[model samples]
Target: MAKAVSDSAQMIARMAPVLDSQDYCFCHVADDHKFHAASVLATFREEEGLTLVLPLAQAQAAGLAGPAFRRITLQVHSALEGVGLTAAVAGALAEGGIACNVVAAFYHDHIFVPSAQARDALSILQRLSAAARR
Candidate 1:
């Protein structure tokens, strides 16, 4: 397993932005439409149905509404038990009037924001990183 970073400053400094071209969405997988593709980004089972984050094209092909989200991946590896990293990131984005939905994987932190605001979100994050390094 990759080492999880706990230092907030280090995490911020290393938050290289990675943008996915395909728009993503969270939708309930229909009974006839199970997401078995390896490319499916993530999934969670819920009482209503299977919630999934998959490519916008795939979701459209599956007849789901477009989620129209841009994914920004933080390159830093953050520990699941790490403190304040999420709070800091979220706070920065919030202060910029950007809504962020974050998913913490074992190796990295993924943030989903509105596609229209993606570029501005990146700028906000970059500034946050720069400020942290000061």
Candidate 2:
């Protein structure tokens, strides 16, 4: 089994960010709507409702006109105890005037940025990794 990385520097250096082709959007469903686990990427329960990260087409079909996003998966097996990766990523995107929504799964970290700025976000992440390699 692959071991998880906890060191911040190692995580940054190894986090090879790959931008997904599919555009996605966040939707809030409070009613009795059943979204298949396979259909949606991820879901979070908040005080108000359940936030679902779904593909763009699915969201559009459901009549949602929210902000679209592109996912950038940080291909590093980071431990839950890992530090600084999210902060560094968020800080970098903030400097670029892009908002970031991060979902830290068991394996890798997924970053969602505005669809229009997907390429820009990917470039920023690549540069971040390269800099960590220096």
Candidate 3:
């Protein structure tokens, strides 16, 4: 089993950033819309609808529309019980005036930022990690 890392500084210092190529969007699919394995990155049941993180092309094919965003995976193996990593990472992005939507999974944290700001976001995260190492 992979050890969960909860230390804020270590999480930051060890964070290896990976930017995904495909554009994505949050979409709401009616209960009747059949879900295909390829269309979804993540899903959540909501009172209003089924919320999903889906690839832009797939979402568009399903009749959903939205601005395109890029996915950035923080390659640090963040334990689900980790503390402060989200806040610290979010703070850095906030300081850079970049908006981020974060999802914390069992092994890693994913950040979705607008496509226009994706590179900048990655740079900011890299700098944050470098600073933490000092």
Candidate 4:
């Protein structure tokens, strides 16, 4: 029998743990802008806006978004519950006094937190995963 989406171990494992040592920037450009072609780097876009992840220094030099945003990547299965998953992770981080901004894609969820709080946010996620397993 095919595995149910909720019970698939492989799906759960797809939530890869990303280290929180890097700083990233979220950029927003005009919908018709072709900035991607202007650079060789990969950029992520959605119906609402575009987000680019670059080194903090580079982002600053490029004069992108504000300096307050921190970038984090979370490996989550496409089949996982959206609000529930985000809420859980956010709740955990909130308990630790961390702020977060989350973006969900077709295959994974990305989180942005204060650069200084990345480690704590990551540890909160690790604890969430461990708690879920039990």
Of the candidates shown, which would achieve the greatest lDDT relative to the real structure?
A: 2
In model 2, which residue pairs have backbone atoms overlapping below 3 Å? none
- Model 2: residues with Cα > 4 Å off, grouped in runs: none
> Which one wins by TM-score: 1 or 4?
1
Candidate 4 wrongly placed segments (more than 4 Å):
1-16, 30-54, 80-83
Better of 1 and 4 by lDDT: 1
lDDT tens readout by residue for model 4, 64-119: 75655555666655454534667676877889999887777656677888888887
C-alpha TM-scores of all predictions: 0.89, 0.96, 0.94, 0.68
- Compared with the true structure, all predictions reach lDDT values of 0.82, 0.93, 0.88, 0.64
Please give the TM-score that candidate 2 achieves against the real structure: 0.96
How many residue pairs of model 3 clash at the backbone? 0
Question: How does residue 20 of candidate 4 score in lDDT?
Answer: 56
Shift of residue 46 alpha carbon in model 4, Å = 9.6
Q: Per-residue CA lDDT of candidate 3, range 3-120, in tens?
A: 7677888898988889999999898877677879665899888888888899999878878869889999988898778788899889999999999999988889999999999999
What's each prediction's clash count?
Answer: 0, 0, 0, 1
Q: What's the residue-level lDDT of 134 in candidate 3?
A: 97
For candidate 1, lDDT tens digit of each residue in 1-112? Answer: 5687887778877677677666898778754665666858987777777778888877788787665898999888887787777898899999999999999998889999
